[model samples]
Target: MGVHTLAELTTFQVGGPIAALYEPQTHDHLVETLRELWSEGEEPLIIGGGSNLVAGDEGYDGPVVRIAHPGLEVVPAEPGRIVLRVSAGVVWDDLVAHTVSSGWSGLEALSGIPGSVGAAPIQNIGAYGQEVSAVLSAVELLDRYGEDPVWVSADELELGYRTSVLKRHRGEPAERDAVVLTVEFVLTDAAGLSAPIAYGQLAGALGVELGTQLPVADVRASVLALRASKGMVRDLSDRDTFSAGSFFTNPIVPLAAARSLPEDAPRWPVTPVAVEPTVIPLDHYTGELPGYAPTAAPELVKLSAAWLIEHAGISKGFRLPGSRAAISSKHTLALTNTGGATGDEVAALARFVQARVSAEFGVQLVPEPVLVGVEI
Candidate 1:
């Protein structure tokens, strides 16, 4: 079979061709194709909706497995709690719509995210204060090093802010050689009520205070509207939404480092819990009970990426000389393809932005998308 170009498969629309692109329509076919590739000494690149990926101009020469199997089943669980076993290929927004329409609440905040269910847990995808980890039950995974698929609990994924065990960090291979076959989410019925609005912007839009619960449908609508305003919702006619959303993630810095920045910089504290005193064994005790010294928990602060970019002198719609790539006019965080931008152009722009931010604020911005054969 002729392969699809990464340009043809990715949201960035700037990659070169691949040796093969397999879109398996069934779970069995997906597994069999992966196994065949592995047996042939090929480690296939798995792609979902291609929303959170960036590929290079040189292109990939190996098999590219695109998970397209679609299924969503409601598993019976305890009352007021619903469990959904969703296939990997299920469009993420479609799942959100289904849950909201069914009077579910947990996924409403992540309404306009463009990706597949399979990709969500890989990054512990979150928005508007609601993360996938809040409701994830388990992931059905096909371990590349094991025989059959197994169900790994959510806690095992070690989901953190926009990261997980399945995610590959910069300059590192994927931590886990497993493919997500399905994801199970345990959501609340909520009796048509949405989860508490934790983000101030979202809360204001809903005309409620933080921790207030509105209608699930209303919450979805407000979130979609907010995302559209920021050019996050995908639209074929809108060039501002052409790029992968949020090129750089909000950087998490320690409290001391965060304080070094200007006071106006947007910052949010990630509070740490109090640590309990360690118990000493009688045989290992060296002296009297340890002095009642209280240790202050380390404080983590999330600095806004968009703020850093703007402060670094890269304004919205900023572009290099004669470069086809530019920052999105609607959002500073998005590095857009103005028109006919190559992967190299996009990567160069990303590196420029990173250099500017790092030089100005001493904060190195990291690319949020999974780059294939490309470095920024």
Candidate 2:
């Protein structure tokens, strides 16, 4: 009931104050509250776990909304499948842990990532070869401009590499005008066996070959250990975890640009998997099968942003003179608040890193967080 600041709402822990805070405890209440606000010509700043946000020191001048409706229900699932419907406000990691403990075959590889269920699809959050899109089936959302609440297929969101239609980036309007209310996932019930491993690092940690399937619980344990070692998993006792994990996303550039960087810079070709040609029965065969030449996609490379930052004269744990914000000592991709750091200081550090990286390799790093009232 008293004053609450964005610092308290976000992991970054450095914003001024909110004009008003709304925490709806029920799904119906959430919709009702937002509609009422919209009717009154007020659009609140909506937040969930606040893991991927960087607010300004001056803070948001408008009202803020935090979805607090708790839901994690196992609904009707077809044979060999598990259907779990999660409310927008449910803690994402809690869902993962629950699934793993219940012998669910999916969501194990995504352990330790922060934020709420509603946020997962917004960023298409992926880690250790498993993406939320792989299991997500549909979502229910409300259109801010009075579009009726409806269920939309996951494909409608246009999920891609760390971006989705719902995500507002660089202060631009979102492609879609809707707020997610809930999400539905179709998980597997493969006798507790996980999906095939696709990440080399995770495989190495699990002491298995790539594409090996292990117990869901084991995979979850390994993922949690790996994340904790890198100071990525949030822990109250660790100052290194006081951050919005991974301040910048890995940069994707043309192969030529990638090759121009130091040979040691880690890079992987961005290639899509080939789709098998469709087969038709002899009696039902169609003529020619429609000969069409697909346009060739130019070769692009995904570069290691951490490697670039370290090589561009920015070391892990580097901090500006007299600033409390410092790059995390354990992870180069993260910018952490040592203690009492301001949002402006964080932005300054981010801009400095951007300038140095661009000057060194001509690669512009894109920030991963949602910025409010701050320019970087």
Candidate 3:
């Protein structure tokens, strides 16, 4: 096979070409390929479905490794629990559809998301009040900075709001430089019943009260419909779908900072983790041991990025004078490529939105996509 351009592989369709592309058909082959790349001192970019990427116009100079290991197996587990081990390359939606059709319940709410199974745990992908972290049991990953692959529990990944130890932040390397080879999910039989509905929008669309449990198939259909209406599901005819889903994550800020926003602004409480202190020897202690107690601080609040963007005076469909990229007409959170848009055009629009929102609300919006050679 020939080397393909990043635009040909990604949903955004705006990046430059790759110097080389390799798709390993099996898990062993994938591991070997990665080991070889690392041995050769090539920091190859590992791309899954390319749904959450924003590559720069000036092509990637390194190798592009694509995970192609495919298939799923029902692992033997405790009674009443179904453990599904899925290969990294399996299409995410296909897995959702299969599970729903087979009467499995846990993943029905995540219906139309675009990406591979391997990419889900990296960001702890969530929507409609459910996260993959909730169901993920373990992951098989090949450490880029280590000598071999290993299976780690989900808790060890430190899955949080749209982030994981495997995800690289703006200015820091990933805590664990690894490539997910497979994922194992522990789901209940549910006997055809769906998990309790949690998100208000999903509940309203399903005509059910929050916490109500509906049929798995019904929930999948409703979730898919809701996503499509928001221009989140992919559609070739809709330019709005030509985007990296939500461009910015909802900002999580301290309670005081959140309260400064207008009363009409949308906000949700985020639970905080407690920090433990290091113990010291009694003999090495200072003159007096300090008496201390850990009291819970005000809960963090997650503010809506879309609300800030809209209230900041950037309406849906807003675009720069010379850019083909524009805010999605159906959703304020998305910045779409209206055919032939370049990476710079998308970056410019994103920067414009960030600037406007920050200037108006005093809140800095962070992009959600993984940028390759593109800065905002």
Candidate 4:
């Protein structure tokens, strides 16, 4: 394709033109294409759904590789569980729908998240009460410096609160050089019952207790409805839906910083889960025992990013003087492209929000999307 328009490729619809584009639909083809590009001294920008991405208006000069595989394989597993090997190019929502329809119970709560399955592990995408890491088993990825694709266990990805080692920080390359080709999800067959409801809003909508488990399909429907209410689920006619979901991740700050906010502001304790204890045989144990260790102080707290933006004086639907980019009318966390918005305009709006939040609370807000050529 000559002079591909990146605005049409990304969900934000804000990028300019691209000189080279490569769309690969199969595993071998993608690997071969990357090999050729690498041999030519080209480090192509790889893309999945572009749902959580923002590209600059000037556009990119390098080659672009868009993963578009459409394969979904059912792996043999023991009874009471299901293993699915999905192509990285498969749309995430479709997979969720399929799982729900097939009575697979793990991914129902993660229903409306945008992007392909291949990109899911990069950010450990989560919503409602469920996250991808909860169901993910492993990913087959190609290590840039290695020869062929290899399966890496989910634990190796270092999944944590909307982040993973596979994800980039501040426009930098991912710490890991691997590019995901396939994702394996291990789902449960718990009589088709959904996972326990963890989100308060979701529980209220479903008319159930916080730990209640409903039918998997019911959970998927409720999650989709919840996302739609926030302008999260895509609707072509709704510009508010034309966003990269939450522009900023919920900021995790020190407990001291959180205490500085208003009394009514939403604040949640951030507790790190204890790792599994190592086991030692009685015969292997030495005579001397270790000394008592003090417990780590609870110092980190998660602050609501939306609340910070609103308290900083930016409201939902807030727009710059002459820019088409604005905060979502339905959700303060999202910055939307209200038709014909340039990448620079969105970036400006994002920077303004970040600056305002920082200036007000002395806490820096970080962008959540994978920005390509766009700076915030």
- In TM-score terms, candidate 4 sits at 0.93
Tens digit of per-residue lDDT, candidate 3, span 92-150: 99999999999988899999999999999999999998899989999999887778789
Runs in model 3 deviating more than 4 A are: 278-298
Candidate 2, backbone clash total: 0
Local lDDT at 260 for model 3? 90
lDDT of each: 0.91, 0.90, 0.91, 0.89
Better of 1 and 4 by lDDT: 1
Write down the TM-score of every candidate.
0.94, 0.93, 0.95, 0.93
Candidate 1 residue lDDT tens string, 165-235: 99988636778879999999999998999999999999998899999999999999999999999899999
Candidate 4 lDDT for residue 302: 90
lDDT of 1 at 344: 93
Residues 222-317 of candidate 4: C-alpha lDDT, one tens digit per residue? 989999999999899999988899999998887877888889989888885464454667998886556534455547889999999999999999
Q: Which has the higher TM-score value, candidate number 2 or candidate number 3?
A: 3
Candidate 2, residues 1-376, lDDT tens digits: the string is: 5678899999889788989999999899999989988989996888999999898899888889998699988898688899988999999999999999888877999999989999999988988889999998999999888646899999999998889999989656679978889999999988989999999999999999999999999999999999998898999989889899999999989887987998889998888445565676889876656564454555889999999999998887899999999999998999999999999999999999999999999999999998888888
Task: Indicate the worst ten consecutive residues by lDDT in candidate 4.
Answer: 289-298
